[model samples]
Structures are given as structure tokens and as C-alpha cells.
Target: MRRYGIQPVASITDDLDIAPLLITSVGRLLWRYRSELAPVTMLALLIGTGTILHSSYRLWWPTVAGITALVAGVLLYAGRWVNLTRPIERAYAATATAFAGGWLTTSTAHGPFTKPLPLVLAIGCVVLAAPWWAHRRRRARVRVERTLAAWPDIAQAAGLAGSRVQSAIVDLWGYRFRLGLGLGQTVEDAVAAVPRLESALGSTRGGVRVQPVASKKANRADVRVIETDPHANAITWPGPSITFITQPAKLGLFEDGAPVRVPLLRRHGLFGGVSGAGKSGGVNVLLGELTACPDVILWGIDLKRGMELQPWASCIDRLATTPQEAEALLRDAVIVLDGRADDLAQRGKRVWDPSPARPALVIIIDEYAELASEAPQAIDHADSIARRGRAVAVQLVAATQRPSKDAMGKSAVRSQMDIRVCFRVREARDADLILGQGMVKTGWHAHKLDAPGKFLISSPDHDIPRRARTYLLDDHGVHTTTERHSTHRPSLDAVSVQALERAAEMPITEDAPPPSREAEKVLMAALRQAPAEGVRINDLMRATRMRRTWVYQRLQDLARTQQAEQVSRGFWRATPEKHAQ
Candidate 1:
């Protein structure tokens, strides 16, 4: 034998061990291709069993078939016990098991080499094996096996030499493995070596992510290998998902296609993003659901001259267009809040429970930075509400382009936000501004969001950084929702109305100005110029220079005399004769 790079063997004993060497070489070859030999090995085992049964126990074929059916049934329904998560994969496994068992039963009744039995076995094996070979999970499993086989070398090269893969799960998006660090190693070391690990494991540049396992020991990590993109398209809205004001509103779908249900009942939320980053669309979805609730009273402050909130003005109880109106509206809300608190105290209740008679107040503020700049005083009231309103079911949902300390009027507004959504931002630090400080460094990479609707939510229920996309509610949707729900919109409860009356120092009237000659002429002018959609209570208050109680009282008297009409809830306009008069 020719040995190119070795010294010549001169000893006869060293060269004479051919038999043992041949056996050892064959053993190594079999070990190397063991997975590929699995099917053939199983086939051989089946053939041996068939021969034994046919030769000595052919009468047991019926029992074999019964056992086969039972096994197939167990495998089909309880396949999760064996790690089959997908229904299709479980079905396939059951089918294969049935085919093999039935073929073995028939073969046992005849012989392993029986002509038709052999043919059926051959055809069935190939047919069943086709799916096994083509299955994604099976392929992924094989890949995982190969990777684990080379893990020692990979770990050594990636500066994680002492770590070992404990277990792995192949998912729809990718695969995740639980890794056990060495005695002195920590999960931080593994996280720090993520880039090198990805390279060593032959994954894409940004494919690997290492998360510490939630355990007291700092020696375990969950290493995920992302092989697929989850946020490839915009998930369409599935309509209003909430009926009552107490349930969480369905925002959109997360990367895993699960619904993103966010609780809006008593929580304050802040939506921050760049211009045209689907912030308005997300808020519209919230409005669509909130409008459908009968136990919620909707209020809005749109400082962009009501451009964003006007579409749903018919449903909103109060809509603020400019700075002065916004200030007045917030002040009134605070009055209502204080009133509810006193009522709760008098009733021996710790918190106000909302019902149709006592609806929760949700204020949707669009472009909150404008409110901060134009009506800085309103921010104080907002801060008060944020700090104390949750228990009483008074919530604020603010959307802003920039929610910095200065942009938010250098108040506790940002800090008071319990639920925050950070959309696509220009800088990494901007994520910290929206989601709170140090969020960017902790892997809340909102700046990496590629799409407009994509965002990361930080709330009590959702603390983990999972990418989610908001359902887009366009202008048509807004108009449709407002029209459908405007009639059912709940008016502010008596407690809030009474509070407003005390603030105005007059008895509130739903229908006649509390005898104000100066306010009557201004109310008439506003009624004449009111748009087809009519004007909201705040607009009428602005026009009439009167409190909402006086406006309602005067409007009631005008409607009674056929001089004015209510176009929608909380919206009134003058009749043709009244306008001319």
C-alpha cells in the first residue's frame, strides 16, 4: 500500500491486522450514515417480524391489526406528546403508521416474500417516505442534528467553547435552542458572542439572537435562529373587536399572527412616531372599537384644526380644534373628574365603576405636541388626569410626532403614560423618549422598524419587545364607523354633568341659554354657519361664549320652537327660518 505522507511500516505485525481493521472501518461507515440507513433498518426489522409471525404465529394477524389501529389513533390525536405540533404533520405520521401496520399485518398472514404483499410494502414505503423526506420540520430536525453534531467546534470558534445545546424547538419563523453554559460561563458571554456564533453556525448576519433564560442561574441562554420574516405585509383590520368598554381593544397582529389585544379600559396610552408613520391609522382603529362601546364617552383634542378628529366628530361628545378650546375642554374634564371622585367618596366606593349610566371617559388627543406648545396650561390638567384618572375610568390616549420632555411641555406627561407605542423613529434615543429611558439599549429597537405601521408596545401586560403592526383604518372606515355608532354613543354620566354644572355655577339643562341675551345672538350666528355635520358642544360653547349647560338649554328651546335641530348627538344647527330670522 502507498502512504504518501507517512513513514514506511517495516514491522509485519503492524500490517497484519486486516480483519479487525475491516470491522472497525465498517462500524465507522455505518455510524456516519446512520440516519440515512434508518428506513432500511426499519424495513429489515419489519421483514424479520413478518417472517416470524407467518412461520409460527400467523393466527395473530387480527390482533396485530387491532393493535395497529389503536396505535395509529393515539398517534393521530395525541401526537403532541411526541413533539408533533402541526395537525398536518400529525395526520401524516398517523397515515404512515397505519400504512406500515396494515402492510405488516397482511405480510404476517402470508409471508415476507409474498408477491402482492412485497409489492404493497415497497409501494407504501416509498409513498410514505416521500412526505417524510419533503417535510419542513423533518428537514429542520435533520439540520438541527447536523448543527448539534458540529456544535463543539462551532462553540470553540465563537468564543463559547464550553457551552452545549440542551434542546431545540423548530418553529414557523425559525428555530430556538436552549444552551447550557459551562460552570464559569454566563449567558451574557453567549449574548456578547452572538455575531461570532451566527458566523460559526452559518446563519445570516442578523439572524441570531440570544436571550437569557428566565432562571436564577445565569448560565443558560435561549439562542434563536430566525430563518423567516414575519412582518412581510400589512395585516388587514378584522373590524371592531371590542363591544364593551371594559374589554381590551384588538390593535393588530403580532409577528406570530396572534391578535394584539391592548387594554384601554383605565390605562393611559401614548402613540409616538414620525409624520405619516400610521399613527393616525392606529388611533382610528382604536376609535372604531371605542365608538362601538355603549359604556364609553369619547372626547377628542385635535389641535390641527380638527383635521384628524373631525371624521368622527359625530360620535365624540366634545371635540377641541384650537388651543383655547382645548384648554377649556381639559378644564371641564378635570371638573368632571373631581365630581366623580366626590361621588365615589360619598357612595363609599374606592373607584367609580363605569356603566351605561356612568360611562368611562376616553380622550383621544391627536398631535399632542401642538397641545403642549399652544395650550401649555392644558398639560397640567392632563398630568392631573394621568396621575389620578385611571381608577375613575377616565383615560387619555395621546398621539404625537415627538414626545420629548420639551415637546411634552417638560412635564410628567411622558412619565405618566402607562402604555406606550413607539413607531418608526429617526434616532435610537427617540425610542427611549417614547418607551421610557434605557429602552433602546435593552433591545427595544424601534428605530429598526422598516414599515410605517410597525411598532413596539410597552405596557403592563406587554413588557417583552415583540414587533407588531397596527390594523390600518382608513378615512372610509372612520366615516363608516362614526355613522354607524354615532347614534349609540353614550352621553357623559349625570355625575360628570353635575360636576360641570357646579363648575359653571348653574343647573345644567339638556334642552333652552339660561336667559343670556348676549349668548343668544352668538348661538344663532353659529347655528346659521354650522356645517352639514353640525357643530360639537365645544364649538358651540366657543361660538356662544357660554358654558355647555347654557348652550344645551338654548338649543333645547330653539328645537322646541322648530327654530333649530340636533343633526347628531351633541351636534346642533339652526333651521332655515331660524337662520333667516
Candidate 2:
């Protein structure tokens, strides 16, 4: 009897040890596949809830149905509040809720164990769970969660141990996280570890980006993992983004699929990249947007005999194809700038408010390096426009293969460009020439951009470095767009036109003042005797024995006082009554 008892007790003790091991194994599996098992767990919960309600509150099925309907309706109509932004996600949520509630309501009335009810619940759960398990975004979210959960190990493998993920978000392209660094760690440290991080996370080369947080926190960095490349192809132009110059122009798209809208109303922009880097494509996209604006008069200087800008000549108010023409265009732009500044001063306004009758001037210079070297005299005027053009809505958009000090000229033009776009540069230091000093070290890695049209923009709206791609406007696109927008193009404002006319009439000598005696009398007499076509500004300068500046200023004053008027650009005439006087 003792031998038999000892054998049975030993077998029971072995079984007890195996039971604990089995429970531990199951718990590990449930934790390992928590995201994947969510739907199964939810179904189990629903079954238990239905059974409990059927036992105690069978009569409350109608209330449960009504509440379920209300909740499903909210989920269908307003699921964005719950972070369900996609239409399919909202629909799935609503359908899942309806299925769960309908099962609960029926089970509460008929009992959860009733013959086909259990079978029906199982079928419905499978049907709904299929979509939940197959959802791409959901899978991505789960993957991001698991990766973040393992970030400590990943960071350690990448020589960045103790770095913690503060917050994370998953989007269509990829995921981004705010990382809190350990003591003595910096964003540069994280940037330098990008390759290691990509390897640690099993990502492809150049798949991870480390940027400094917008808050400028010393110990924080924004890390982006590019699971899907958004700028893999050239984005086609979607036509003009704005009809007025005041609104921001949609230049391209960011990696997160957001529009790269930068306001060009009163800002100078610089575009720098190597040849064949799609700098021209970016310029074309910008012109497509700016040309559509009725309150912007477009002027272009393409020193390569208009090779780059000739396609949009129908829309550009002035297209300079020669070095002489380029120099003249920039000189006239400065004259217009001075004229608008004076007008704003007289009106007691701090800025020029552009309108159809008073349009803003946007000068686009393609191959700016050529202009700098070929027409060096124009750099001073370009510098002046860059310095003071913003207030009066005179903007300069300069595009160059390389914006070196020698290529951009020794001027403030590069420094004053508030919106800087660096495309696929040949060297890292070239980014600093285009984007500003110390930009390369700060993670503005324009040199790493591999594809044409891929760029990094730095502006008041976009201070952080994010990869973006410019819209493609091929030759056909440029032709169609220019033809569509040419009819809507506004002529230069009277102030700018008159200023250009005076500049055209100026003598070779610079800043020469008018004769002190009989200048006003001679100008009035010339206007009275002027042909019906009206007197040219050159003729007026000759008649008054005055400088072009003096003649233009007096004419503007007389026209304002209703004593004189412009017959055409650079042409003026006196009123009939004033001539009689």
C-alpha cells in the first residue's frame, strides 16, 4: 500500500510542474501576439458580456440596441475625433460596432448559448476580424509599436543607449518619433547614427532621418523612419495653387504628403542645385503658380538665350534672353522698387498691397550664376531688390547651378533670400552656400538627395529639414499652363511702368540732377506741344533739360494733381484745360 501511494503522489507532483509550465507558455504567446489577437480577445469579451447580461438584465436588450445604434452612428459620422481619419477605418469601426451590438442585443434576449446564435456570432467575428487583421495602416501601426517597444535595444545596438522615445506617430509614408536623449547626448549624435539605426531597425539604406525638434530642446530629437518613400516619382503639377500673390504657392509635396506651400508675395527665394538636378523643374513649377496670379507681373531673366524660360514667354511680362537685356531688366526692377517704396511712403503705408491695377513684380532669374558672371553690373541692383523688395512686393526668385560667393556675386542677394531650396547638391558644403551657414552640420543633408526634383526647403514656414519633391512641369505642361494663364496676366503697375520708362530715358551718366532754371516751364510746354501719341519720357527729359528722375517725379506730381496724365508707358501729356492755361 505504501509503494502504490508513493507512485501515485510522484505522478501528481510531475503533473503540477507541467501545468505551471503550460500556463507560462500560453501567457508568453498572448503577450507576444497581443496586437494580432486583439479581435479574438474582443470576441471573447463580447461572449462573456452577453452571457452575463442575459442572466441578469434580459429586459435591457432594447436599451442596449438603441445605445449601440447611437454609438455606431457617431463612429460612422465623426470617427476622426477618435483618430480614425480614413474613410475605410471609420466604416470598419461603425460596422464592427453594429455587429458586436447586434450580437449582444440578440444574445441578451435569446441567451448567448441559443442554437444558431453562437454560430452566427462566430461567423460575424471572422468576417469583421478579417479586415482588422488585413488592414495596412493597422499593420503599420502595430509594427511601429513593436519597434518602439524595442527601441532601447535598437538604440543600444546603434551606439545610442538610454535614448527614449517620448512620443510616436504612424502615417501613410512611415512613422516619426520624438526621442529624448540621455545626458550629454545631442541631436548631432543621433544624426551621425542614422546608418546604424537603419541597420538596427532592419531598414534599407537612407531610410532613417534624424532631425532636431522644433522646440529646439537640447536633449530631444525628431526621428523619422521612412517605411515607404513618398518622393519616389516626379509629382505632376496640379495646376496653379493660388490666384492671388498673397496666398502661399504650392511648390511641391513633403514626405508626409503635405503640400509645400511657401508664400512668395513679399519674399526672396533661392534655388540651388547641380546641373540635371531638376532645378529647372522646380523653377517651372514656381512659375506655373506665380503666372496664374492676376496680381503678379512676372519678369524672367534667362541668360542662356531664354533656353530655360522661353516656354513661358507668353505669360512673363518681360523675358530677358541677352546679357544686355538681363542687366536692363534687373535695373528696371530696382527702379520699380524705388518707385513703389516712394509711393508707399507717400501713402503712409508700411507695405504695398497688390491688386490688379497695382500688381506686384516677381523677377525670376534662371541660371543666376551666368547673370552674375556675364552681367556683373546687375548684381548691385539684384542685391538692392533682395534687401528692400519684400515690403513693396517686389520679389526675386534666383535659380543657379551653384550659389557660391563667386557665382552668386559678392552681394547680400544670397544672404537676403528668406526662402532657400537646395536640391541634389554635389557636395555637403554647397548646401551651406544655398541654405546658409552651418546648415549642413544641422542635418540639412541636401547632398544626400538622390533623385532629381528632390530637395530641402528652409523658410519661415519650414525651418526643419524634411525631404520634398518638386512638381514636374514638362515642356508641354509649361506651354499649356502659360497659354491658359497668359490671358489673365496683369501688366506692370503704372508706378513700375513709369519708373521703367524713366529708367529707359536716363542718360548714361548716373544720378545727374535736373537744371535748376525753367525745368518745370519747359516740361509743361512740351506736354502741351506733344503729339497725340503723347511725348516720350526721353523727349520730356530733352525739353525740360532735366534728369529722367526729375522729369518722372514732376510728371507724377502733376498727374496726381490732375494737371498731367500718361498716354502710354513712358509717354505723358497735359490736360487740355491745363494746356490752355
Candidate 3:
């Protein structure tokens, strides 16, 4: 038994010869824990450098100190480039570098392990290692490495057998990996296998996401796994993000905390979401911004008896509560539109440039479906404005519970919207209805939004399907913002005011009333000078500074008195007897 197994060693060697193997194993173990052993390695390197410098080039210690000072200075401002993202991280890096460099410089001039120097090095190493070992991002990176090491098997089980991870980034909310798909494989395949991949990676349902790399290619995908959700809580609205109508309206925030800003200038917007999905909250945020702009004049149609837009009534120039009033408001807006258009044409300008004197007009319609059902006529004018208003700085911002074709019927008003914000919807098809056709298939799954303010936007500049949330301006906040900005609000310019006055002075129908002495005189003069054939109602109205109804009433009186006569349908002329006068 004593002679058995070749004394537990190779046949040509004794057991003592196994020392080399043991040493090699220990070296590999140390290398495996290199990050944890960093402080010790640094200390040894400092000692070695000091020993060599003291023996050969101790005079270079001052130069070492100067070089260390310069490096620390560079790291102060440029540390972000090296992944020292936070100020504290930069401070720690600079401090560590300075301490190590200073110790080496002092040790080089004296002895390698003099007096309190060794003790200081030991204490400093422990202190620095504490932060390094407990860093959240560092731990995330290590976990990512371990997870990636098992990715080959995970990929095989998840139906992506040959794909390989090209790169990865660990962020605050989650980690993402850039994948290189196998030949003949596609991003669709990866997307289809998302559930399987989530299970294989030990992530929750809906935790795994796959997006195609924005290229003309289908073989690359970016897989994101959410370990934490950044948008789980309500983001408090930071006051007015912009003070002018020309700036983008800062809405809420994206998942990465970037502001969701969509320009409101000269753009018609639609916000659609179910009840309690924060559609009103979204409108409140918009009102907060529009009220702050002196170059913007706001009008609102709150068909819910002004329940929704009442708090900001102070800032709104006109608020329509009933369907009749809504229709009249839109009609007046058309008059303003015509005036602005004619003005621009005369000046040879293609667009209405907004300013304090020539402010832009923004009409906010809450529960637009009610407007469609109650004031159907208003929809026609709204459609006209939507089609032609962008150039003249007259735009609509309508919010509705559902934007179904029936709810937004006849006008195709939904089609003209330039910016769309969609909140939580009831069905997969509803997302398409609110955003556009096939939006759910394209990854704008508004039905999946978990919170009230969460939404998805589709705009000219943002064509991709990224989820967002609208800023929540509560009742108190709304009142405060409106009151603060009320004094700075701009009035309607002269052109717009005259256009509205011309409309207001007009009678509703020819049968309503008789004109005053001066009004009657103006009408009689217009009829007496009418063209031989006839003068159109519009022409007579414009010539007499009256409305269509007013012109008709005066013409009717003139005809009855033999001072005017109808030459044809919708045409009028002065009679021979009247010409004699």
C-alpha cells in the first residue's frame, strides 16, 4: 500500500515536484480576483517603483509629483470620458491617483517602507477599496458578465441559437446588448422569441424587448432587459419649460428621463386617451405652456360645462361652454383666418410670423367627440382651419377619449394632426386608432402603459415608437401658472379684432331687425351704385362695412321701396327710379 499509486505523483517525479502546479493554480486564482485585488497590486507597484527610484533616480521624485498633479487636473474636468460619470466618482479617482503618486514621490526620496508611510498606504487602500467594491454600476457590470457567459445556452434555448452578443451597456434602469444575428436570421425572429428569451434570462414577462438597429438591415437587434423601471412614479412638473410659442413644449419625460418636447408652434396636435388616462392632465400641461407665451392667444371649448379647462380661464381669451357657443367661436376663428390670410397675401408672405403684436391662435377643444356630436357645424370649420391654418398660425389642440372614425367623422380632422399623444387605451386596435394604423404592431403599445400620465407620441420629428408621459399640472398648479402669466398675455392684433368685429356686427338673418339711420344710409348708397347686372351679397356686405345678413336686410327694404331689384339669384341692382334719385 505504501508503494501504491506511484506515491500519488507522476511516475517520473516525486510528490515534492507538485509545488510548481500549486503555484500556478494560486497565480490563476489571484488573476481571477484582479479587480478585488487592485488596491494590493497598486501598493506593491508603488513600493517597487519607490525602491528602484531611490536606488537609481531619486532626483526624479519632484518630476513624478508634477506629472501626478497634471494628471489629477486633467481628470477633474475630463473624467466623464473615462466612465467617471458622477462628480463623486471623479473625486474618488483623482484622490486615489494623487494619494498613490504622492506616496511614491515621498518614498522615492526617502526609503521604500519608511515610518508611517506603510501604515498610510494600508489605510488608504482599505478606504478606496470600499467604494470600488460597493459601486452599483460596477456590480451591475459584473452581473452582466456572468449572465453573458451563459448566453450561448440561453440563446440556444430561446430560438436564437447562433446569435452572439457584440456589446452591452448597463444603465440605471436596465442593461442592453447589441446582438449580431446569425446568417439568414432576422430581427423579427428575435422579436418573436422575446418571451422565450425573457424566461431563459430569468426576467419578468414583458421585461425583454428587441429593437432593430436603425439601418437598412434586419440582421441586427438590440435586446433590452429591464431590471428596474425609471418611470414607475409620477414625475413632478418642472415649471414652464419654455416662455415663447416658438419653442418646443416640454411635456413629460421618456424612460431615460429626457424631456418629451414637441414643438407647438404652427402645429395642430391631438391628444387621445381613455377616461382617467390623463388626457385632461396632458391638456393642463399644454395650457400651462401656452399661457406662458405672450405671442400666443388661447381659446378653449370645454363641452363638459367648462369642468376641464376652468382653472386656466384667466389666461384663455375666449372659453366656449355650449355647443352653440363652440360653433360661433369656430366661425369667428374662420373670420380671423380670412383676415390673416388676406393680409399675408397682400404682403406677399407665405406664413404668418408670430409675435407679441401678431400672436398665434391656439384653440383647445376638450372632449372633441362631444363637439362632433353637439356642434357638428363646428367640425367643418375646424376641418377648414386644420387644412389651412398652419400657415397662418391658427392651430387646433383637441383631446378626445376615442378618435374613432365615427367619433371624428366627416372632417378627417384626425388626419390633419401634426402631433399625436396617446395614453392608455382599452384595446390593441385602440392604439392604432389614437396613434395610427398598425401602431401596436410597430411597438407603440399604448394599451400596456401602466400609469396615468404615460403616453406615446407620433410627430414629424419623432417617427419611432418610444413611450412617454405627459406632465401633470394639477388644479392648484394650473391656477398658479395662469395667474402668473395673465398679466403678460398679448391681445388679438388689430387685423384679427376688426375681422371679429365685422362678424359680430352682422345680423343673424334678414328678418331679424332694421338698421339705424347711418347703417340704412350706407346700405342704400351701396344698392344705388350696384352694377348693371348685379352685385353679389358678399360684395355688398364688404362695400357697406356690414355682414351678409345685414346686407340682405337692407337690400330687401330697398327692393320693397323700389330702390333696389333682384337681377338674378344672389344678385342685386339699383332700379331705374332709384338711379334717378
Best by TM-score: 1
Q: Go through the candidates in order and give each one's C-alpha lDDT.
A: 0.83, 0.87, 0.83
Q: Tell me the tens digit of each residue's lDDT in model 2 across 417-445.
A: 98999999989989988998898887899
Ranked candidates (lDDT, high to low): 2, 3, 1
Where in model 2 is the C-alpha error above 4 Å?
1-21, 504-581
Best by lDDT: 2
RMSD of each: 4.6, 7.8, 11.1
Please, what are the lDDT tens digits per residue for candidate 3 over residues 344-430? Answer: 999999999999999999999999999999998898999899999999999999999889877886547898898999999988898
Sort all candidates by TM-score, best to worst. Answer: 1, 2, 3
Higher-scoring candidate on lDDT, 2 or 3? 2
Superposed model 1: Cα runs more than 4 Å off: 1-38, 52-59, 74-87, 182-191, 212-218, 506-515, 518-539, 547-549, 552-565, 573-581
Span of ten consecutive residues with least summed lDDT in model 1: 506-515
